[model samples]
Each structure stands twice: as C-alpha cells, then as structure tokens.
Target: MKPLSSTLAPGNGGAAGQTGLETNNAGRDMKIIATGLLVLMAIVYFTSKSYEEVHPALGFVRAFAEAAMVGGLADWFAVTALFRHPMGIPIPHTAIIPRNKDRIGNTLANFLKSNFLITRIVAQRMHGVDLAGGVGRFLKSPSGGEGRLKMGASRLIGDIIASLDQDRLGSMFKGAVKSQARDLDLATPLGQILEVVMKENRHGPLIDSTIKWAYRTLDANEYVIRAIVFDRANTVMRWTGLDDRLANEVVDGLYKLLADMASDPEHPVRTKSEEALAQLAVELKTDPALRERIEQWKLEMIENPAIADWIDGIWENGRNALLKASRDPDAAMAGHFGDALMQLGSSLQKDPILNRQLNRFARRAVAGVVASYGDNIVKLVSETIHGWDAQTITDRVENAVGRDLQYIRVNGTLVGGLVGVSLHTLGYWI
Candidate 1:
C-alpha cells in the first residue's frame, strides 16, 4: 500500500496541463487586480492633496492608502511566486510546493510519523473495537461458520490423510501394542474416547448393522447347502447302498440336525461350542502359549481368502463413500460431516473455557507464524521498493492525485492578497 503522502501527489500530463492553465489564470488575474488596486490607492492619495498638505488626518489616510498599495503589491508578488517567477524574476524559495515535490513527499512522511503514528493513539483506536466478539459473531453465521470449519479442518485432514503411510501406521500400531503380553491395557485417554463411543451407542450400530446385514442376506442357495447335506449322506449311502426310503430318511435327519444347530443358540451342542470359545478367550488372555497360538490364529485368519474378500468389500465401501462425498455435496452422509463440524464450532464458541484455551493456542500459533514470516513482510517491502523505479513511483502518485493540488496555488494567491491588505492597513494604523 502506498503511504498517504504518496497518494496526495500531483497528476501527470493532464494534471500538469491543468496546473499550467490555473497558474496562468491566477497570474493574469493577480496582475490585473493588483494594478487596478494600485491605481485606486494612488488616486486616493493624490485626490486628498489638501488633507495631505495641511491635515494630519489626510496625511494619515494617504500613508495608509500608500502602505496598503505596497502591501497588496508585495503580497501579490509573493503569492504569484509560488507557481512561477514573481514579476518574471527567477528567485530561490519561489514555487516551493511544485519545485520541491519530491522533497515535499519526504517531509510529508516525517510529518505523518510526528503527527499520526503515536502508539497510544493507535492502541486506543484498536482497543475501541471488540475484534474477538466480531470474529465470533461472523463465525456463528451458518454459511460463514461452515466456511471457517471447512478451511481449518480441510487443511488439517488433507495434510494428515495425504501424508499417511500405511506402513508407518501399521508400525505405529504394532509398537503401541507391543508392550503388553497378548493383551494391552488401555490407557485412560483411549478409554475415555472409547467410553463416548459406547455412551453414544455408535459402536453398537456398526456391529449390529454388519451382523444384521449378513443374516438378512444369508446364502441359502440349494445347490451349495444341499451339496453339503448330500455329500455327507452319500458316505452312508455308498457304504450301505441303503434303500431309497432309508437314504431319504438319512438326508432328512442330516438337514434337521443342521437346522437345529443353526436355530438353537442355547442347545447343548451350541452351549459346548460357546463354552469352548469362551474358555479359549480366557486362556488366550491368561496363558502366554495360548496367547501366541491365538495371535497365530488371528494372523492366519486375516490372511484367509474370505477375510481378503471382506476387506476388499470394506475398502470398496469406503472408497465409494469418499467418492460420493466429494462429488455430491448434498449426500446426507457427507453433509452430516459438515454439520458435525459446524456443531463443533458452535460448541467451542459457547464453551468459555474451551474458547479461551483455543484462543490462547490460536494466539501462540499465530505469533509463531507471524514471527516466522516477519522477514517476508520486510523482504516484500524491500523487494517491492527495489523492483520499482523512482520515476514509476512518482508517476503513479502523480496519476492518482495530482490534479487537486493546483488548488493550493490558487489558495495561496488569494490568501496572500488578504494577508497583504491586512498588514498594509496595520502599517497605516501605526
């Protein structure tokens, strides 16, 4: 930004033209007016000859009028000199504002610092503003609120997600879980976050939804299920070559048993299976050898084809969600995320203690950023100044505000004449 002084500079070509025109007009007008005034004063002095010869009052009037003429002439000359040579005489200290335009700019800068740059005044003006409240108010609006949330969250999440190294993540997880034997003791911080998910019942839905979906879509394909039934029944049929009725009876019994197992969770057979699993879970938790076996089983299970297929499905679901989220802003699932962010912002704003903490963090962050970038600001100034030619600076200023300055010359001439008349009158009065 250009300084105020630079902004007030005279205009170029057109401004120069206008200035020239005004200077000429003022000069012509001043000369005509001064000469006319001089003639009038002379007439006054000569016409009162009787008073001048005998009367002190007439003499005094004559002196006064003569002095007034001299004052007016001197003032007119002085004022005219500001724009051009007075009486066509080239003298120093004339037309100062024009001849010393660059100097005037430098002095104007000094004047600004001396007159306006006081820290107390600046601080007072700034303190009068409730900047924090205004910012809060702005961020409270729906659109504005969303915009602010997106800006910060997107910056953070983008950086994090983009820089994610799966290997590093896996290693970090492994390292984190490495201290425990078989099972890790959950940290309080982790537990607290987990508690919220539990309290909110968010985790229940995920497990319930998955199980429900799997059950609802159970593969009841006749060939696949019947194949298992017939394959087992065939062993008996092949061994005995049983009658058709016996074969049919055996297959029916086999299906009934499978159905019974599937339907009855608390059946004796199911109880035994459940107990064995529970016992294993306990053994894995308490026994080192059992824990290693369990870990091996877990790793093997993860490497299974079915697990890969499940994982592939999960990856597809996640990718699809992200794709839809990024493309379709109106997608409820994605929009909910934006809404959640807005809610977070609102919560932060309402929570005074949290707000103060955030503000402190923000201030420190801002101060660090400012400190780091402080040189850039100075560098920018230095580079800008270095890049700019002096003539360009002068021209830019002149273009912006040069025309109005010609009025100064006009004011000078008129004001000078008034001062001259006053001084001349005072001279006579004495």
Candidate 2:
C-alpha cells in the first residue's frame, strides 16, 4: 500500500478536485471582499481629510477609515506571508510553510508516531478483534462467499498450472522418489509386519487357502501323477511285481493322503507345516543372515532399470493427469480445495481450543510485524512530505484553510474601525 502522505500529495489526483475548486473560489472571493473594504476606506480617508475643518463628523470618519485601512492591510500581509512573501518581496518570517517544510514534516511524523503507532494501543485494538472468528463466519455465510472462493481458487490453480514446467516437475518427482527408496531399508519393516500377522493368528486364512490350492492342483494333475508312478515302478522292477493295478493303487493312496491333510487340521503334515512357517517368521525377525539376504533382494529390485522406468512412468502419468485436470473447468480440483477450506473453517469455529490457538497465533504475528516495522511507517511519512514540492504544499494547505484565514482580515478591519470611532467620541467628551 502507498503511504498516507503519498495519498495526500498534490500530484496524486482524486475526488478532492471539486472540493478543492470550491475552497479556492471561496478564498479568492474573501480576498476580493477584504481588498474592496480597504479600497473603500482609502477613498473615505482621502475625501474626508479635505473636508475635516468644515465638518466635525467628517474628522471622526477620517480616523475610522485610516485605522480600518491599516488593520485590513496588516491582516492581508499576515495571511499572505503564510503562503508566500508579501507582494512578492523577500520578507523575514514570511513564506512560513515553504521555509519550514522539513520541520513541519518531522513534527507531523512525530505526532503520528506518538499518537497512533503505540504498541499498547495496537495490541489493545487487536485484542478486541476476533479475526479468526470473523473469517470463519464469512466462510460459513449464505451469501455465496463460498462459491466466490471456489471460483477464485479455480482461477488461481489454473494460472499456476499453466505457468508450470511439467517436465521439470516430473524429473524432480522421480528423483525424490528414487532417492527416498534408495535410503529406505524394507526388510526389517516387512519382517516386523510378518511377526505381527503370525502373533495375531491372521495367518490361518492364508494357510487354509494354500491347502485348498494344493488339493485343486493334485486333482487336476491326477493322470500325470499316475504316469510318473508307473514309470518309477517299471524302472525299479520290470519283470516280477509292479503292474497297472499297483500304480493305480499308489495314485489312490496319494489322493487320499492330500484329502486327509486338507480335512484334518491336526494331521502330522499340517502340524509340521505350521511349525516350519512359525520358525521362518521367527528367523526373519531374529536372524541377521536372513535379513541381509532380503535386503540384497530389495536393493536389486529398487535399482533395476525396469523398476526405475516404472517409477518415472508413474510420475509422468500422474503429473499429466493433474495438469489436465487443472486446465479443465469441470475437474472439481478447485471445488475440492474450497470444500476443504470450508470444512476447516467449520472445524475452527466449532472447536474452541483450535479457535483460541489460531487467534493467539494471529496476535503474535501482528505484534511481531508492528514491533519490527512500525517505525518505518513514520519514516515513510516524513520522506513523502519532504519529497513534495514547496509550492504545491503551500497551495494545498492554503486551499484547505485559506477561507477561514480570510475571515480574520474581515474582522480586523471592522473591529479596528469600531475602536477608532469609540476613541474619537471619548476625546470629544474630554
């Protein structure tokens, strides 16, 4: 914002033009009337002096006119001296405003600093204001403030996205993701998750699913299993004992064994499998060698060219989608932002603790700003005043108060004349 002094400067054009014109006209009219009165007095003084001996009343009139002229001229000189030298001649104590511009500026600045910029005054005013509450109420108003906020947000986001360098953003996104992945160790966290799953008995579903999958595989590949068993029997004993019936019986026994394992949770095979899985979970958590191997595998996956390309693709695709959404008016990205802001405002209003904290934060921020920069405002006022042209300052000030000053000239003439008449009457009586 421009300084207050700048706003009052002469060249800063504004609505003051018509008002200034009226003041100027009034000052000019007053000056003319005062000058006319002095001219009338001068005429009476000269005419009455010639007839004073012939008319006693004319002698008193002459005295009044002389005093009136003197008073009017003196007042005119005094008023003119404030803005400029009387009759354009150099005179001491004249052109007061122009000559003392710097001092006047300093005085004005000091006045403002002492009266308006006091920290206690500012803090007291701030304390009386509920800035956070006011904002919350405005957001929650039914006067379409929320709709305007949404539209404003949409335009702001659109402008920002339009100005962005998409390629640069994508590159930065990929680099950050890769850097974070490289610095992270996944094995220990994964092992801890597995430990939690086993401890919580969440692994039962997984074991049951595994058994069902194995049974389906065995049923589907029965012919292959039987063929393999028959081939094994031939290789071991070709001439004497093994035959088709025995192979069939062996395949039937294998199927029955899998059925038993799937149906009975207490079977030896099931018990052994659970024990082995439990041990593996324990080893993953406590064994350093196992962890090291897992870490090596993780590193290989992260560093692989295919994985890097996939990560880059994810960034590029996401960026493109966001950019497209930002440009589309119907995308609702800005609407979502507005809704989130409204929700936040509602929360702040409903939550007393949050509202209090927000107000406190605002107070501290305002106090910090005032404490740090309040002096600058005073300096700015002084500088702006100093920068104004002397004549411009005179014209503006005279225009503002010149009408009132002219009345002083009028009163001086009338009072001086009245005193002269009273003195003449007293002298005659004596």
Candidate 3:
C-alpha cells in the first residue's frame, strides 16, 4: 500500500494547526506500519510457498502469510474508500464522503436544529445558567486582565453611535419625545403633584418667599410712592405741608400691611393665597373644562416650533455627549456603566426573587431568539458546508479519523493470520 500524504498544508501554526499536523502525521505513520506489515506478509507468503515442499512448517507459514496479506489489503481498500477511490480509480461505492458531502451537511444541520436548537431544549439548558450573575461578575471586575472587556464594550458602543446618522437619529428621538408628550395627561399628574405638595405644606416656604419679595419691592420704591402721593395731593394740602405727612402715612401703612402678612400665617392675604392654590389644584383634578383647557394647551405646546427646536437641541446635545463619553478614555461613563452593572449584579445576587425573575426573563429571551431565527441559523450551517469543495471535505474527514481506520488494517492482518493458521491445523488433522 502507498503511504498517504499529510492532508494539512505547510506553514500552519497555532493550536488548531498543530493539532491537524499531529493527526495527519499519526495517520501517515500508521498507514506506513500497516503497509509495511502487508509487504512483510507478501514476502513471507512467496518465500514460504517456494519452500513449502521442503518442510511441513512452511505450509502453515505460507497459509498465515497469504491470509494476512488478503486481510490487510481488504482493510486498506475499505479505509481508503471512505476518503477517496482506491488507486485513484473511479470505482462504484468509493469516495463515499466526497459523494455525499452535501447530504451530510444537510443531515448535520437538521440534526442540530431538531435536537439542540429547539426552544424547549435551549430554555431548559439556559434555565440553570446564572447568566445575570456571570454578567455582573464580568462587569464588576476586569475580565482577562486590565479591564479589556469593559473597554471593548465601551468602544463597541462608540462605534455603533459613530456609525449612526446623527441627523436621522436626532429626528427619530425628537419624534418619539413629541409622540410621548402628546399622549401624556398633563393636568391629572400636575394636580396629583400639587396635592402632595399641599399635604406636605411644602408651599409654605414659597409663600413666605413671595411675601418677602413684595416687601423688598415696596421698600425700594418708597420714594416713588411718596412722589406719586404728593403729585396726586390737592394744592391746599401741598401748601400746608399736609401732603408730606399723608405720603409718609401711606408708605408706613403699606409696609405695616406687608409685615402683618409675613408675620401671621393665618393673615387674610395668606389664607386667601392658600385657598386660591387649593382651588386651582382641585380644579385641575376634577374640572372637565379646566382639564380640557390644559390638554389643549399641552397640544399647542407640543405643536409649537419652539418645542420642536428644543427637542432637536436636546437630542443633539444628548447624542454628542454620549458619543464623547464613549470615545473619551478619561470619561467616567464607562466606569459609571461598570458600576451600574456591578450594582445590578450585586442586587440580583442578594435578592433571590429578582434573580429568579431575571433568569426566567433571560431564558425566555434566548428561547424567543432561537424560535425566531433557528431555521436561518440551521440553513446557514448547511449552506456553508455545502459550499466547500469535495477535496476539502475529504481532507477534513480523513484527518479526523484516518489514524483509527489504519489501526483496523493492523488488527485485520493479525486476526486473519491467526484464523489462517487455525484453519491449516484443522485441515491437516482432517
């Protein structure tokens, strides 16, 4: 038998390359050993046949050698037929792998789709996997040293954003914001917020601030008030100096009234202000006319060019900020992202209910993806294998199992020799 050459091409390196080279060498070596045994058997068979008349022992030796050669030749032919036709002849049932490569690819793809990629099986397998915990740990610590995973993720985000059309993205964002804003019930929420503020008496500080502002304004313009009072006075009052006293009285009275409102929480003006605010809040909540007006106002605001421009500005600023954060090495966005991930992970770890829910969600998500795209994935696998040339298919298959097949030849030769010797002994006795 001719020794089969190595299937692996030259200059192949790395673990995969080394593995292929090793297997190829092993198969080649075994093929040589098996062929050498066959040659030795052939030499013995011819020599023993020539000397068979000289000695009875030669008869048994000739029988064993003859049988061994036959067995080795049969096994070698069988093994070679798997990858290629024996002696390069286009024999029937030969080169089985190459002939059925496409079929094999389809069979493999269908088997994977039916058994492995099924939604139930995938979900079951994922059910036990703590994907969230794994993600959390990865986010919390630098994976494979020096935070490369985090940096890689940040760069990926940056690349995705960079690849996007900023103007289009901004437009979409603005549209979405307007859409949501249009759907919002502004009056009810405002009313609820106002109710909460009043319940907590948070408006007290605001009222006090308003009072103080008014007092300051009146004090600053006292001279103006006095001049106005003097101008409005009659001629007799001005000549008698009564106008000056009246102006001072008017200014003092105004200051006292403001002071009273500030010092007394239950003052008439304060009470009236609270009542007015309370009434407005109630009207916002329960008055249909008021609510309708608010809704109309909201619609108008949403439709306004100024609001559209604001939304555009917001989207631009946000998109630019995100892009900058993603690109900047010194930016804390990545660190913040990592920290948020870590916090979420820690929470998932600590909270059993949350962990279980998240795991269920993850499983469902994965199962959904599999259900949706499993056929496409299977088709991809089949098409990829089918695309390969017959020679490529033959080489890969032979490289994988050729060594084991060569062992069969060696075993066949020895087993055939023993059977031949036993048969010779039985025939002689008979």
Candidate 4:
C-alpha cells in the first residue's frame, strides 16, 4: 500500500518533479561557477607570468594562479568522469555511473532489501508507530476541510461499485450462498431455534393465531358445511328442515370448540400441539433418520432452480440499492456509513485493548507483506533502473550530487594555491 501522505495528496508527484528540477538547476549553476573559476585562474597565470620580470612578487602570483588552474582542472575532470567521459574523450574508467548503472541499481536494490525490507527490521521500525490511533484520528477529524475525507471516501466507494460487473458479482454471490447452504447443518440449527421457542413458551402466540384462522375459515364457509350436511342427510329429514337444524348445531359446536381453544391457554388441543412441536424439535436433533431426511431436503433446496433464482434476485436488488445509495449525496446509507466510521474511530481511540489489537494486526499484516513480496519489490526496482537509458541514469546521478562535487573543485583550487605560495616561500628561505 502507498503511504497515507502519498495516497491523500494527488500533487505529490508534481512536487517531487519540481524538487528534482530545482536540484538540477542548482547543480548546473555550480558547474558553471567552478568552470569560470578555472578560466579566471588561467588568465591570471598568463598575465602574472608576463609581469614576473618587472616585480619579484609576480612569481608568487604566477605560481598561485598556475597551481590553482591545475587543481581546478583536475577536480573538474574527476567530477565529469563520474557522469560521462571528460571532454567527450573515451578515457578508461570514465563515464563510471553510465557504464555501471546496472551494477549500481542492483547494489542499491540489495542494500534496500537487506536494511529496510526485512520483516524483522520493518517490524522494529514500525514498533512505535501508532497506526490505529493515527487512522482513528484521521477518520474522526481529517487533515483537510470538514467533510472532505468522508466525501472523497464515498466517491471512491461509488466509483469502485460502478466499475464492477454486476452480473458476475451477482453470480458469485449466488454461488457463495449456495455453497454455504449446502454445507450448513440445517437440522441442528432448526432444532436449537425450536428448543428456544419452546423454552420461552413463545409457541402460545402461534397456537392462538392458528385458532383465529380456523374460526374465520369456518365462519365464512358455513353455507358450504351446511350443503355437505344436506348431501349426506336423508330426503325426509331435509324436507322437514331437520338437516338445516343439524347443520346449525354442528357449526355452533365447531365455533364453540375453536373459541375454547383460543380462550384457554392450557386447553387439551393447545397442550397437544405444543407436545407435538417439542417432539418434532427433539426428533430433528436426535433422530438420525430425521436428520438424514433434512440433509437430503437441504441438498434438494440448494439444487432447486427456484432457490437459485431467488438468490440471484436478492443479489440484484441488493446491488441496485447499494449503487443508488452510494450515488446519492443525501442518502441515509451514506450518512449511516459516515456515522459508523466515526463511531468506530471513537471506539478505537477510547478502547485501549481494541486499539492494541488493531495495531498488532496491522504490524503483522505489513510484516507478512514484506516477507512475502520483499524479493519481488527489490527485483522490480533493479529491473526499472536497469531498463533506463545511460544518459537518463547519468543525469539523475549528476543532479543529485553534482553541486557538492562542484564545491570539491572550488576547495581544491583554493587549497592548491595556498600550498603553492607556502612552497615558494620555503624554497626562497632555503
């Protein structure tokens, strides 16, 4: 992962480019100064040599200028040879950086891998870093203006979702659901749920609902019941209206039974229903045959086209809803997501244990990445450098340290001039 600073700032690359440009300009200016000093020394040397016969002091001046010129030229040659051949001459051991660019790249890569990319070294360096706290602070109150972080994060999420293949995503989601369902032990969970219901007497409401439904059905179909009674009745009984009287009695009796079941919680029918449910729950859990049947049913359901279609529909609806929510600026989901992030950040900040765990996890994750991909990273660096042209490598190296090297030329010229004057004095004294 890129550093947070680089990730957050889009202009970092431009800034780095500008910095390199500035460094190159400084190096170029220093090179001109160093070369101009050598030219000045040469002019002085010739002028002082002509006046040496007129004044004895001119000999010392001539010696200083000549020595300064030689020292400056030597230093310039050394500096020039590093990046390219001196005066474009193909001198041995010249153009050192360009000729050995590949070796330098490999050496640099190895140095980085050995010193920085090792898991142990990385872990040690990251030991004091409060990654979790830093993240928490960033999320809670970002560096940029208010709501900028949240908005950017939301936009990123929206883009990612928009770019995905919805059909493929839906298919993958459906497949995952099917796989989970296929592996799930439906019988055991069902039994556990049923047991909880029974323990809490939650099945009472179900019984009451059943009774009410039965009562409504019987009331609405009274005529149907009466007609059935008439079809079974004798012709004499129907003609005398006795069958109608009997149907009314039967309907009234059924209504009274249902009423009793509804009014009485401990009614025999209710008790019997509860007992049956409890027994089924136990059979679901403990009975091997029943469990096997449930497993087979679960497999069938997983294989059913209707179930697959239902899963696909679920994925489609969910994906569309998420997409719409992500796109909408004033969406409740977006607000909720932001709020959740803030809450998590607050929790991480206040909760030491959670913060520590998160930090440990982050460290381990980073260390694992370094251990796994360190070699690949080194190889990439080496290959990238090796692939660059010789001139490109030379310019980069020169820009980085060329100004300092120019200073070396200036120092050598001054130092050599002082030494020459000292030597002339010593020889005259002898």
lDDT of 3 at 430: 100
Tens-digit lDDT string for candidate 4 (1-430) = 2344453442344445678778878988988898888899899999999989999899898889888988888888888899899989999999999999999999999999989999998999788999989778755654336455566565556667766777788778988998888889999999999989999989888888999999999989999999999999998998999999999999999999999999988889888999999999999999999999999999998888998888888988887777676555445334667678778888889999999999999999999999999999999999989999999888777778989999999998888788878888888999
Model 1, TM vs. native? 0.34
Identify the superior model by TM-score, candidate 2 or candidate 3: 3
Model 1, range 1-430, lDDT digits (tens) per residue? 2332332344323345577567556555655655676667668767755566677556555655656555556665655555556766779887544565555555655554455444444444444444444445544454444654544443344344334565575445444433342343223333455455645645544444544454444434434544554556666665665544554565566556556656655567655654554454455446667556656666666557786566556555654564444333334223567667556656666777766666655555555554566456544544554555555554444344344333333344445445545665677679
List model 2 lDDT by residue over 1-430, tens digit each: 3444544445444445556777789999988888888899999999998899899789789989888888888888999899999989999999999999888899999998888777777777788778878777755552454655655455556556556677797778878987888778676677777778878878777778888887788789878876776677764454665656677687788778778887887889878877777787787777889888987887788889999899888987776666565445344334766577677778778988888888888877787777888899899989978998899789878888888888998888888888887888888899
The C-alpha lDDT values of all candidates are 0.52, 0.78, 0.85, 0.85
lDDT of 3 at 56: 74
Which regions of candidate 1 are displaced past 4 Å? 1-51, 54-56, 80-83, 113-121, 130-195, 199-202, 210-430
Instruction: Report clash pairs, candidate 1.
Output: 10-402, 11-398, 11-402, 82-95
Model 2 lowest lDDT segment of ten: 1-10
Models 1 onward score TM values of 0.34, 0.47, 0.60, 0.66
Candidate 4 weakest lDDT stretch, 10 residues? 1-10
For candidate 3, write residues 1-430 as lDDT tens digits. Answer: 1111221233244345778789999999998999999999999999999989988789999999999998999998998898899999999999999999999999999999999999999988997899777765554553436465566556667777777788788878888998999899999989988888888899899899998998999988999988998889999999999999999998899889889988998999899999888888899999999999999999999999998888888987888888786666345425767577667767877788887888889999999999999999999999988999999888888878988989999999988898898899899889
Q: Comparing candidate 1 with candidate 3, which one achieves the higher TM-score?
A: 3
Give the C-alpha lDDT of model 3. 0.85
Question: How do the candidates rank by TM-score, highest first?
Answer: 4, 3, 2, 1
Best by TM-score: 4
Q: Residue 35 of model 1: what lDDT?
A: 61
